[model samples]
Target: MLTRWRWFIAVAAACALPSAAQACSCERPSGDLHTQLRTARENAVAIYRARVTAVDPAAFDGKAAVEVLEVFKGPVKPGERLDLPSGGRGACTIAFKAGKEYLMYAQGKDATSVSLCSRTHSVTPGTESELAWLRTGKLPPLPVALQREAVSCEPCDIDLVGGRLIVAPDESPSSWLWPPQAAEAMKEGRPFFTRAHVDSEHSLIVGMSFDGKPFELTQTHEYAAPSACTRRIHLRWCKRLDVTTPAGSPHPVFKCIEPGESSLQCDESKGRESSWRPPESIPADACLWRTSDTALCTLEPRMRLLPAGARASPVLKCRPQDLDRRDRNHFCQVETKPGPTDKAP
Candidate 1:
């Protein structure tokens, strides 16, 4: 999930366009409010709050002329008249009605086209938040249904000491710690290491630590058995392990057991245990793991390092709205007013 968020943030930051479509399929806009705003600001050639002053009646190639009421971006000025593409039966083509107001995200320098794929839509109560954000450059508060009590896990501390990563484990319910013998071996600097579980679809590997830190590893390759293996049934089987390291680290060293065995190996060792470090290259504001699966720390909305533990309350299930939209497989945080027991210690 964190991997998905990282990828989402990168794509949202770049404001990359969706692939060209031959049919009526639109990429879903991000559920993140800020991401949506950033994408529109960066990707659209022109944007405006305007009223459709006139519309051509042609069935396939009709155009709508809008009178710009307010310009949020581009060279267009208030009250300027611009003809934009409208009324088409094909996929992603939009139809505009005269005399209606709209928030237009227009393509091209001439601002002559509007696509359903963009956020262009009729102005209504539904768009008030977006309009407010554009006008004030501040994200409006999430709707009541979208707001939720901030959830936190039990506290754990992760640090990098002497080029080696160390996690100070706590008694949190969600803590992922090595057994006592392994912990002792790690302290003694013995040759013990944990294997990372790979999620090939996401191209991610999650490595565990004796303490509680989880390393999210990226960039991986898989090798298969050679043609010689086809001649021998037993030789057809290849030993392979996907090894991953923190993004921006040096290329990982392959430490195969036998000659030609496929595996990932790292050089840095602390005591007898192998440990991976947090991404030193990432900004402090970026998310970092606090436990194997429970919580993350971020510096931006104030430095917050939640501990790893069971959730404070049963998961709150509710309908998706605004920024609270979540994929079907996941449950989003639902609105909950803070109670006295919810106060920070």
Candidate 2:
């Protein structure tokens, strides 16, 4: 009787497992690459190589999946090759260069680039454009560690997918203005900047000594993504109210404000002002994980957390056992090196 009961329990537990294949939806957990593709295909995601037969901005509502006909374009000339991401149902069309390969994703409400797999092989010129591409090169192993570097006591998450590295979500605010050094500079009646002396938004706050020379920094903060975990951020430094230079330009002399980037000019003609604002919803001098604020994570169907320091730190905040497991049934192994596709000729 005991044996019979044991057998019954085993059978019930086995049946509880979810299907190996499922659609890419919110309910689904972020999964391995094979699973992502399977579900994406079901959602009508496909790759294509066609000419610019026509265009419809409103097709997928703002997320049009354009089609570039094979007729012609610069590098990707007629009969050559090209790539595009699509909804596969013809509901939307994303734009691609006259003739080139592009990886597309189903960006959410706003317009954003879909996550493309750098590890997957490049799509053939004529395949569907919306289809996700995979990276073909070798990849490092899953992070072996995670750690905390910030003082607020907030921790960062990191993730490894199909051998790709990712940082976790960021919810910190810039309200922690005036790190230690910035505070001291103010008290000394010296000319000091709020951030690190690196840039005006310098992670290091800077202050002037009695002789108007540079001295001690109150704090050091690395600029990162604001909210999403994909976009990298840009930083700047300033010696005066409106005059700011790139992180590493001559500043001690401070004769004239020389803006390095053409896009960023101290154009007194445009009115001298430098209260830096993020291109998107980001704050100055903070870390960001995502590439574009309007962009979405396309590599996986669901979101995954990338713990801080998992790439190299000795400690990890997220428990190791807490790390989940997926079936080996799909996707190639995370490779630090690769074996040939076929045995020796």
As for model 2, its CA RMSD to the true structure in angstroms is: 20.9
Q: Which residue window of length 10 is worst by lDDT in model 1?
A: 225-234
Which ranges of candidate 2 are over 4 A from the true structure? 1-29, 41-102, 108-191, 195-256, 259-333, 336-345
Candidate 1 runs further than 4 Å off: 1-22, 29-31, 143-345
What do the candidate models score in CA lDDT, each in turn? 0.40, 0.24
Q: Indicate which candidate wins on lDDT.
A: 1
What does the lDDT read for residue 49 in candidate 2? 36
Tens-digit lDDT string for candidate 1 (1-345): 112232222221122111112333444434334555676678888888999999886534568888999999888899898888775333356668889999888865556657766667788764676777788887644322111223222211111110133333342223222233333443465422232221111122222333433333322211011100011110111133233332432323122222232233321111111121111111232322111111122222222222344233322222111112132111222223312323321
Error of 2 at 338 (Å): 10
> Which residue pairs in candidate 1 have backbone atoms (N, alpha carbon, C) closer than 3 angstroms, thus clashing?
153-307, 154-307, 154-308, 154-309, 155-307, 189-271, 189-272, 190-271, 190-272
lDDT of 2 by residue, 249-276 (tens): 2222121123222122111113211121
